[model samples]
Target: MDRDAEKIHHDDSISHSQREASSAASTTVFAADVGDRTTAEGPYPRLQDQKDDVPQQTSAPAPPSDTAPQRGKWQKAIIVVSLCAALFLAALDITIVTTALPTIAADLNSGAGYLWIGSAYLLTSAAFTPSWGKISDIWGRKPIVLLAAAIFFVGSTLAATSVNIAMLVAARAIQGVGGGGLVVLVNICISELVSMRDRGKYLGYVAIVWALASAIGPVLGGVFTARVSWRWCFYINLPITGVVFIVLYFMLHLDNPKTPMWDGLKAVDWLGTIAIVGGTLMLLLGLDLGGVSFSWSSATVVCLIVFGLFSAVLFVLVEWKFTKNPIMPLRIFKHISNSAALGVCFCHGYVFIAGSYYLPLYFQAVLGASPLLSGVYLLPYAVSFSVTSYATGLFIKKTGKYLPTVWFGISVMTLGFGLFIDLPSSPSWPRIVLYQLVAGFGVGQNLNSPLVALQAMVKPPDIATATATFFFTRVLSTSISVVIGGVIFQNEMERRYSYLRASLPEDVARGLTGSSAATSVGILAQLPDDQLQIARNAFYESIRVMWIMYVAFAALGMVISVFIGSHILTKEHTVAKTGLKQERPVAEPTEQERA
Candidate 1:
């Protein structure tokens, strides 16, 4: 009887051990599957626990289950359309006011204050972008985007109804706050919805909307100013924004992580925000005012430059040491890929903006085209940019590589800018258009690649912050480039005019030296034929200098792009394989189970 009992007991013990082994194996498989899904589908990086049978929480919400209802083609189409419309509205607002400025100045009798109409919007937008990005990460994307649209709508209404220039400037600043957020959040939202591999195609579509808006904005502004009222420029945003808001409300669905309000508040780097905003404002103010409103040596400009530099330094320190949650995380710069990509982005902005701003000057001041005709002449750039952007996106989607494409784009841009130096005093339309097309194609190739490369380098949670930094750098570079280009052009024109002044009539020399001679084709047209020819020659030489500067910038971009670390663009949204380890607890057996 005792031997039989022992045999049964041993058999039961063996059965229990087998059951435990099977359960452990199944758990290991479950964890592996979860990890795969996290990398393959999650917007943020998956927590990688080293211990067996340990549970980990992801920084971002878990990705939707594969079995979850997938969005149909039509549903995705609606979402894309809605996003594009919102993007168009934001981009249009930036340039649409260019032609309307004169009408606005006349209607409001703004005089010198007219400059503030554009300055206020730009200043507030640049300062507020990163902050808005951080906020979106903490709160949620959809709510913040809706809030931005609502703020933009209110600003538009106020702008349309403003009785004085002060009110209008105020309204524009308000609009800028919303506009800044819209641009950043839209990109983030798209990153969340699409896989990294497929993201470029959708980004290409966004680029199309942006390019179209940029091309059409001035034309629409002219129509409104001439046929309707300048107020329509502001009023038009209302209906578009309303439609976008409605569509977003219905179609956009995202799972936002919930954090306590106090925790969210504590997570913000308030000091860093203030320092950065103040620094950017001061820097931009100095750059904007240096040559136009005040001399570079003036006390106001000097003080602003110094203060801006000091604040910037302080901001870096705060981000590095003082803040627990940095507005611009210092660690992002640790990756060579990110640092190099940002450098390229800055140089790209400088070259692109310089081209955009100065090409029009060449058309109007040197070529003697009318304002409307000058805008029409820019069509080659817009169309080629759109085409190449879409094509490059498709190429990246297929190959899952971006660095080589970026290198090719920058090389082409450098070549194009180099060719601009050969522009004749009176070139044929085809010659100029072909030059612009080459540059535009180059611009399109890499315009969206930096963002893609940046997104790929970081974990998903950092997408918004990284994007905001990219944009802030680009914006800052553009503002500085425009100012620098203006300085170069103005100084060169003045120098050339001075040399020519020795032989010309006093009146003609003085007129040629005036600011209007460099900006207004109408003023150039009124000059005597002899004086007009001299003015055109002077403008041509100055524009050539600007192009040479652009060449240098484009070349720098190409060189910097070489240092961009190559990574296999993964379809999986995993943390960058940066050799960082994740910690997790190991499951322990209960005392009864052990016994």
Candidate 2:
């Protein structure tokens, strides 16, 4: 009876051990299931990276929720078109305003105060671009972009109703706040919507929008300012902006970013913002009217120079040491590639400012073409830009290398600048078109390549900073370039006009100028033919001097381009916390285990 009882106890022990082994196997399998469930429940992995396979505690703002309304195909298309229109409008404004400068002044009966119509808009737009981008990153791009559109429409409304130059300039500045949002936020949203391989295509689309707008802007401005009224140029934005606002409200629901909104807002470096706005305004003002508004030695000029310099110093200091978040974070220069990229972008922007302003002069002034005709003449430029942008995007996808394409694009631009440098006092229309085509082709290549390169170098942590640096450098350089070009043009024009001060009729020449503000082309257009001839000569020669200065500066961009770091592929950042995280260990149950 004892032996039988022992046998029964041993069999039961063996059965219990077998049960324990099965339980362990089930737990290992179940652990993986729990991990899968956790992953399934998590928010967008797009916005976060886990360290040590543990999820990050903080992340980018959650995008518009899963509960947010959805859109149908037609609705989505309309929203996209609206987005494209808003961007195109912003770009168009930049080019269009220049074409109508003379018309605005003549119609408003304003002096050089009218130059601020364009300069103020530019400064204000560039100043707030980074700010809007950061805000969108926190609050959501849709709201910010919409708000900007509303503001732009209102400002345009005010501009159309303006009774004086001051009002027009003020309205333009207001419009800039909205314009700034559209131009900047559009790019940010596009970055989020596509994969790396496809990103270039979307950016190209933005460029296409810009090109189309840019291509047609002067023509539209010419038609509007000439036939309808200069005021209509401002009014046209209303219906367009309204349609955009409605479309976005419906179809542009994006995933909510995971970054903290409040944190990002608080991170905005206010001091940098203020300094940039102030310094930039002062510099632009000083440039536009330096020779005409106030002599270089006058109190106004000195004040502008001093104020701009001091404000700039303060901005740099604040960004370096004091700000919790710097608008143009000085720390972005920590990477050599970033610094080089900035240099290249800055060169590009500076040259663009000087070129955009002066290139049209050759058409309108030298060729005696109407504003509309001049716009038509500029068509080849947009063509080249569009072609190069599309071609380069394909090259990037296939080759995964941008250096060669970039080099070719920049070289073409440099050659164009060289051609411009050699452009005589009067050149044939073909020469003008040819030179423009060269520059445009080069610029098209550059438009998106450097940015793509910059994005390649940094992780998401630095994306905002890198983005800001890219745009900030461009604008900052532009502001400086405009000022420099202005001062040179002013001095040279004054020197040329000095020939007339003593010889011309006293009535015509009397108080003809006092450095308060020089007579603009519009104001000069009102002068008698003989007097117009004198002013035009000075204007024409002075404008040439500006282009001469851009040649070396624009060419310098290539030097910076050559130094961009080796091509690095973007890959996954966060690791899975659980998985076949490890293989289960098998137990050896002694020599008889297999049985």
Candidate 3:
């Protein structure tokens, strides 16, 4: 063909591809156009045309240099905002239902005998997280994210209409699976599209989602339970999630069909996933039911103990040898920062969530606060997490790294957890709020730190695996904490209160007859005063040990942070198999050499 004819052909092909790009919108397309290359050699590396291995593929051969958007600028801020909301909904479900359980139990004609509602979701979410993360990596974040949204919405619909306790628990389990995906996968989306340098700046938006959801869930739940129905809390996720999913459909088409599946799926440690889940579930259940419904020495508890140990041993063995694509890359453990980050995660979970579960019990059972009041008193705590988290995002943006702030966050959380050690069962309102705020701030800071660290350390291709692994440890730790804390509280309360008739004053000791001593009061209540005081003193002592447990975990988390692999900003980069980040060198190594 003639020279002019050839030029025309090339132009036509390029235009066709650009049309394709516009039609498919979910990627964090740099908002700016891809301009001409100024350098004879080009500024960024030439992306290989090898269709299968790469993450970010050049859609229209980089627009003219002048037209190219700045490297850090991106197209999907609104999508992120919506996603943040979805994330909030998913996480909020975990805690919100706990507050509404008593109402549900009575309505369903089941005495408040089943405390398994929270566990059903927790276990299912934990079980499915690795699978969901891997699927998101394989299928791309958009499709799977949409799938999760659908699942959560359906689960909500199911729960809202349920007539039995069994159905409610089952519905929650379904939602938990979806919620698990949303929780673990959002990080992949955020890191993939946004520039690493700009991540911290944009990251605050995520912090807001976490904090606000916790704060809003209970209040909404209370209102729904009192006025509309307990079902509103579940129903609410439907419209909210449906709207986000529709918007996402129009805005995103991110599963780079061009990316080879092997890069993301090839190394997936399925055996590791199986082993981990089995071990984790067994262990969590053993801890959960051992001393509450069944005595620790009972045959049932013994069998559970045996099963848990066996599962753990099997899991470790499987992870150590069998799977071709190991889910939890043991190699990540070789990195000090990853290891330290996980350690911090363990302690962080212990300090924060331990308070989350028990404080409500204290409020409701001991203080006689209504569910709304409980959620309200806890408001400052949840809000602090959100406000500080968003502020931390801004801080990281302005300061350039999350390190200094992380240190401060850990220190504060540790102090906060320690404060609960002195809480008396019958505290004045101000004292309770003060302690709640302190613990909340500490817990809030922790929520984002390790996640940021993991993102900073890994490439986009490996982010799914890394993120799943990180959260796996995190959620797993939380499971263990909840189970263990429950056991401690149950056993201690039972042991302490078992002989209460003889030791206490006649009027004060009478309230120890049933479930009141074991539960939390989130909102302030209209209950009788005598019952409230008895429950309060019992809780004050019970929670003291739980806080003591928190102090230990927080200290452990801090120590882990000390050893975390703080990489000095480096000039190297790796492409995420999942298309989360562009193929570019990440942050410049920190100025300090030791990291």
In terms of TM-score, the best-performing candidate is 1
In every candidate, how many clashes are there? 0, 19, 53
Over 4 Å off, model 3? 1-75, 111-114, 253-255, 258-270, 364-368, 424-433, 503-516, 520-535, 568-575, 579-595
Angstrom error at residue 233, model 3: 2.9
Point out the worst 10-residue segment of candidate 3 by lDDT: 43-52
lDDT per residue (tens digit) for residues 1-595 in model 2: 9999999999999999999999878867765664465455422121222222333335754212222244465765566677788898888787677668888899899986877888778878876766664455454556767788988998899999999999899899898888977887676556544444455666777778888887777778878877888887788888988888887787676644444556555655677878877886676566555655566778897788788878879878887788654555554565555677677778777876555656665566544556566667777776887777877877776666666666787778777777776555554767777887888788788777777777655544345446656776676787778668766665665565566565556444433333311334435545676766665565567666777788778778888877765443332222111111111111222222111
Against the true structure, what is each candidate's TM-score?
0.86, 0.73, 0.76
The per-residue C-alpha lDDT of model 1 at residue 39 equals 48
Compared with the true structure, all predictions reach lDDT values of: 0.78, 0.66, 0.66
Instruction: Report how far residue 210 has shifted in candidate 3, in Å.
Output: 2.1
Could you give me the TM-score of model 1 versus the true structure?
A: 0.86
